[model samples]
Target: MTDSDTGHSPVWARSKRRRSSGGGGGAFFGFLVFLLALFGAVVIGMSIKERSVAGGGAAIDGWIATGKASVMQAIGKAPAAADVAVEKAGDAAAATGDAVQAEAAQTADALKKQ
Candidate 1:
């Protein structure tokens, strides 16, 4: 029926043209987003590969690698430093035990002479 017959136009009779929102703003923004996503993927993948068994293989060995270091080199160094600290602590404990044994021996000898 016409709008004159009804109080107002029905939902199906409405002429609301939907604006196009499919286009990604423009080519520049679309490419920018693609590049950002690609860069992020590559960085994450390389960061993981850097710590893998096949990391920096003969293929990349010829490159000027600063010791096959990852971009997150500083983060990896923490474990190596902690290992060194543990080794030093073990050595110090062993040395302390030896000194205690020596002191005990000297005390025994002094008591025997008394």
Candidate 2:
């Protein structure tokens, strides 16, 4: 706690110097923010189309349209994807049950033969 002799740096200055894991969290958050901004632009794209709003560059408009379409398509496919996932899970469970039953039957047969 004494810093007079060596005049070491203060605790506050040295504290939390280690770099925490970046984990690309910044990139992910940036992408999310960009997505949200583009979605906002899509909402206002109507105004742009009708010239009620300005700053409607083709690239920005394209980004808005693409984001909107991707989102809507994903939303439309989600239910069907869930249904397929459920069906696959059921199939896997049935297969696992059959395998367990077959193993038990084999074990019983082996014990009887012995």
Candidate 3:
């Protein structure tokens, strides 16, 4: 009998063909990788947003403190300014009285000479 008539084939002569069927585990693994990447992106975005909110809160606090300090400074200066204004007014009144007295003395001396 010819060698082909026997059911046995030599291992070196056997077909090494592969099937062209649907992608099995590789496609599922790729989909899992995509989901993991999406999850990572979401986590990063949330982290940035949280940091920004915290920073903004601190900045607002600083502005409020500055405004309070300015108001306190203005309040402290008000009484000093008032005291200076009162002193100046008293001085002006005294000067006006002295000028009137000097004019009366001049009129008396001129009448005595006449």
TM-scores for every candidate against the unseen true structure: 0.37, 0.51, 0.45
lDDT of 1 at 76: 81
Tell me which residue pairs clash in candidate 2.
none
Query: What is the C-alpha lDDT profile of model 3 across 1-85, one tens digit per residue?
Result: 7667997676655543222244467688889999999866755665576576556556556778999999999999999999999
What is the alpha-carbon lDDT of model 2 when measured against the actual structure? 0.82
Clashes of 1: 0
**Position 17, candidate 1: lDDT:** 26
Ranking of predictions according to TM-score: 2, 3, 1
Look at candidate 2 and tell me the lDDT of residue 26.
Answer: 69
Please give the RMSD to the true structure for each candidate, in Å.
16.7, 7.3, 30.7
Model number with the top TM-score: 2
Better of 1 and 2 by lDDT: 2
Tell how far residue 58 is off in model 2, in angstroms: 6.8
lDDT of each: 0.72, 0.82, 0.78
Candidate 2 lDDT over 17-109, as tens digits, reads 433456778689989999999878875885667565554455567777999999999999999999999999999999999999999999999
Candidate 3 local lDDT, residue 73: 100
